[model samples]
Target: MSYTFAIIGRPNVGKSTLFNRLVGQKLALVDDTPGVTRDRREGEARLGDLRFTIIDTAGLDEGPKGSLTARMQQQTETAIELADALFFVIDARAGLTPNDRAFADFARRANKPVILLANKSEGKQGEIGAMESYALGLGDPVMISAEHGEGMGELYDAVRELLPEPPEEDEEPEALGELTDEEIAKRPIRVAIVGRPNAGKSTTINHLLGEERLLTSPEAGTTRDSIAVEVVYRGRRFKIFDTAGLRRRSRIEEKLEKLSVADALRAVRFAEVVVLMLDSQTKFEEQDLRIADLIEREGRALVIAVNKWDLVDRQPGQIGALRTEADHWLPQVKGVPIVAMSGLMGEGIERLMKAIEEAYAIWNRRIPTAALNRWFEQAVQTNPPPAVSGRRLKLNYITQTKARPPSFVVFCSRADAVPESYLRYLINSLRSGFDLPGTPVRITLREKANPFAHKRKRPS
Candidate 1:
């Protein structure tokens, strides 16, 4: 197992800022607002040549049982238990408080290696506070500023002392060897479950995981940051990301919510397939449509998951009606797979998984050059290009450039003259002709170079 370090501190002491700096990304949400982080977030951290797993936990504080703050503290305690070492950070500007002192004692009881960090100790202004931290009795305080990237070398040195030595080469040869195709295939499929607020996104994931891996409540927007969890269903591995519910831009007022929305968007971009979970009780809301559109634009394989299906009034042919609505409302992803399931009762989970796998396979599907051109010829012959300025526009040839949302380029006489309507026609035709459904199809028009122009004499 890799060495683990947990960053624990009181509210607004820059523990998250330090975590972001170490992990090299803003995986944890940071804000001027206290308690932005509620759950323990884990990331691979690197410092110089040393790499280890780092856990960023919520601020340690006292609150009544079942309160949000208390749950956050529970998350922090869990991180402390799992970590081999702890970095107890304090705000140098504000100096140590009674809460900080209390948490210091709490860390002491854990009996793990603790490194005191006097963060925001950039100048002489913080010298007094840094001196005062010595009273915590952890060790020499590593004075540094997380925001400005200062004192990392000192931080690295402190962590290295606590971590065990790297395993020798002879210890594990399989780790050194490159992964084969089968091994790669066995790797987890990266999937993100996204939707508007309180759409049972977390509950759906919990049902899939067969445990309450994520905190779920009736309260809208309980999950702030996108949380990723590994799940195995029927021997198939999946890395599922449960993202914060996205609301319309105008309705989002709080800075924290905006940050959460941005984090959810980042999750979509990184995922191979995205499942847009919709609350069946309030199905096809405006925000749900917008979220699905965003997934289509991002070129991720999409699966429309109608969650809370157990509550739906099952009329005859209701499923067919929902499918028809999906195609009509989101024509950009025509024939997209829609699975109706209740996340609360764990109904239709297998169907959801099948849809996700099918979407992923289609997303990665590639067409052969000869077969693609053959379809291209048939398509063009069926519906030829229209006349522009009384001159017939010539479409020379079409070839697929890539997949994962199959992208193609059409070499034609006048690329600029080709209208958006025609491009849409080609895209729709490609989707149908190639049996590529639901996946976003990209078609680019490129003008073929006039090779014989140089050989032709000028009219003048």
Candidate 2:
């Protein structure tokens, strides 16, 4: 039962910078530009001996009703509602602005314990600004530099006073040891929703949550950070990550966009199953293929989601055509699951969830060693490795080293001489024979050492 704190401030007041410092990681995107964080990001924060949950929200600003700016403020307000306390941050170097004063009043109305943070208070100018913050009637501002790591001792003291005292500890139970297979299966699956800009990645997640958990707009690149949320479908829990829309490297010129793209890539690497969302109007594009290739290379289970299905003009064979295109365009994961849905309309959500579970099961599938060797023997006999450099390539045996992408190692003669075409042939055969669809399979070739070579037979 960790207490939660929401950091509230105007734009570019170093809220995200403070979040990164507290979390001890760059989980939230930080940039010089204002309004960089449109979504409220949460992280486990620790200071001295205190531990709690911290949420970094979008800056509070004035906007016309129903505009994007207004929606951003709504997100900040929601963060405020969920928090047990609030950290009201202000830029000490810039001093207090009218917006800061107005938001200070707003924070007061919430009636939560507010800890005023005068950020960027490192120089003489910052001290003057910190003094100015006292006029807002929010109590003495805790002067600190989020970026330069100054005055954290005073900040820690302020937060410590607000937290309740710890309860008495009971006797500890014995260690439970390793978890059973059934217990492990009950854990949440980590899935990442990624695609090109304006692909409705956030909309899909918002639909799943049945709330506007993330900010979505027609404008491309609305999301700049990878935001993770939990969802339970049919008694199965999923920790899904809504990542920034990735774009082609050549087109990304801005420093902020580059950071966003890097954050999305990190999400992919951390996810167990990656759902590549594509706009139905423009499915199977070049960038989509590249993203899929990257997922395969990373050895994660993949599911292709064709979003905005309602917008497409229905055809008799559209579903079948989508399957064919998925197999043809992306042959690496030949039988990858593809679900067509409208994220806005909430259509086909169940099918998408089912496909994700199925893909995850396949990714973790492992075959018995005996069955693997039998299949390996037949596959080799069907199309034996071609003779290389006038020497026969003898494939002795194959064994599955591990699962979670189903990796294998093959001991053979002249491992280096095996052609790339031969390896591809073996990999494809393994996929079809073992029912390993849509999961990346790895096969490593190792040369078998001759027994007589170690003995000095030439001396006789």
Model 1 spans > 4 angstroms off? 166-184, 458-460
* Ten contiguous residues minimizing lDDT sum, candidate 1: 167-176
Write one digit per residue (lDDT tens) for candidate 2, span 1-460. Answer: 8889999999999999999999999999999999999999899888877788999999999899988899999999999999999999999999989999999999999999999999999999999999999989999999999998898899999988888875334355434346666876988999999999999889989998989999999998889999999999899999999998888889999999999999999999999999999999889899999999999999999999999999998989988899999999998898899999999999999999999999999998889999999999999899999997788899999988888889999999888899999998998999999898889999999988888887775764
C-alpha RMSD for every candidate: 3.0, 2.2
Query: Top model by TM-score, which number?
Result: 2
- Please report, in order, the local distance difference test score of every candidate based on alpha carbons: 0.89, 0.93
If scored against the real structure, what TM-score would every candidate get? 0.93, 0.96
Q: Please, what are the lDDT tens digits per residue for candidate 1 over residues 188-282?
A: 88999999999999888888878656778788988998988888988889998989999999999998999999999999999999999998888
Q: How well does candidate 2 match the true structure, expressed as C-alpha RMSD?
A: 2.2
Worst 10 residues of 2 by lDDT: 167-176
Clashes of 2: 0
